[model samples]
Target: MLKGFLHHYYAFGLKVTSDWALPCSQRVQPTFATLEFRKQQAAFFAARVPRALRSQDPARIHYHDLEDGSRYLKWRGVFEFLISPDSQVVFGHSLDGAPAAAFRSYMLGHVFSYALLGFGIETFHATCVVVDGEAIAFLGDSARGKSTLAAAFLADGAELVTDDFLVLGREGKGYIAYPGLPRIKLYRSMSKHLLPARKGQRFTPGRVPKYLYPMEPVTKPQPLRAFYSLVSPDAIKSQTEVRIEALAPRQAYLEITENTFNVRVQTRERLESQFRWATEVVTRVPVKRLSYPRTLKVLPEVIAAVRADLQASR
Candidate 1:
């Protein structure tokens, strides 16, 4: 039973359902209650959500509220989310749900999936590279160095496309522009050697994350020309660099599967769909590996190399 309500994301049309009913039944309700709850929640999310969120689309931002009651449930992770082409769903346990972990997996996966689906376009869980009116995406595992590379590029004067995710859209015969959003997580640990940032700068241990320069103006997405993942351990010279090259389809699939956090839940169809997306991305935008080192001094060198490569390709 839901004690709260459901809401939809204004810009993305994400639907979220949650429990609002107090003292909810421990057992699951098959039909009536569930349906009623879903409807009510949906309306709640839709009606209450403002038209503008984080100054972006007000219509696309959606959320849910649950009243599981019983704070003793101690549920830390209790949420779920699902991503389909046209829509997405996010759910969380009521107060009685007991633990966030209960919802972490589902919610996280659904969010990741939504990000991957391109927020209605094609999206990747990585930083974006914008150059020559074009955008390239970097995808990888949590600590694989995508943000480091993006930061590296930024240090070299390239405009930031997006820190984490970007929405792709059609533009003048080619798809372009990153969607919305800002602020990428800089793992305090990883930044130790990756950027010039200092340790204490971060609120806690890990990378010294920072907002993009000229913060007042939001970075816009441009045409996409390439997608790369930082594989770590590329030949290190006095200066590290992002080596861009074409990858065999097999290798691309392998790399994507390896980087995917929820690989097991990815069904054959889902896998195929992902592959199809990857293939399309590869065919249109070259996919490559961005291998570099833990040094901030060499960031410019890496960005320079990418710029040179883009110029050469153009």
Candidate 2:
């Protein structure tokens, strides 16, 4: 026995060799058909690499295109990952004594996002909920309450599609939102208030205080019903009422660009494709700005207003 574990991350079945436990909320079998794991021997790079995707000075996180055409990534303190040239498989290596929780966290977030991008699927820094069988996504930067609002929707009986990384693709003439891994990362304060039924576990023991709330995931891709780019708090000055404003096509396109999770890795071809997809998406679907006071007490009102808006759109 290789001593491996099997799980489903988003829609893909993952066979992991790392010493990590799969989420308790989602059902993962003990076996898998397709496997991705770590390399036994580490690879070394030359001092003067000819080609590189992105590299920081301190070299904490870097992407390299090796002579063999594989993609290499290093998350210094966490893990290192390599994506096959064909983008069919991923190889990962967790730092010595690295907790599996931390490995799972970065895998589902940045590493997986990069791999999906390599495979030509676009991901957004957004969270989404299923509203009446379709996906209603909330897009924004960090700390803009994307996850909290998703938890509110989940509390209101909507199934969660994703919490942080939202994968999307085009279906027919409109866009469809793919289901992500069945987990939600919530801060302790928000978890206490929003996720009462589900038990919360720390995302990673020592790194972050956020708790991961695993839930029943919506596995199939759903048609994107609407997209809301949450405005930053400073953008709304003393706003008491929840405001929903339809965004113009240009504005929607810009917001989409900003919220793209792997915008930096986009090549020229990818850039053109994203632009075309975004343009078509904005025309076929509504994109709006959802703004309100960042107060937990008013969350119910905000959720009610969002539902009303969605209903009216339909």
Instruction: Kindly give the number of clashing pairs for every candidate.
Output: 52, 0
Instruction: Write the residue-wise lDDT of candidate 2 on 52-113 in tens digits.
Output: 44233576677766777677777766677777776656777676657778877777678766
lDDT, candidate 1, 105-124, per-residue tens: 23333354443343323345
What's the true lDDT of residue 276 in model 1?
A: 69
Q: What is the C-alpha local distance difference test score of candidate 1?
A: 0.46
The best candidate by lDDT is 2
lDDT of each: 0.46, 0.74
For model 1, the superposed segments whose C-alpha errors exceed 4 Å read 1-89, 93-122, 166-174, 187-220, 234-242, 253-264
Which candidate ranks first by TM-score, i.e. highest? 2
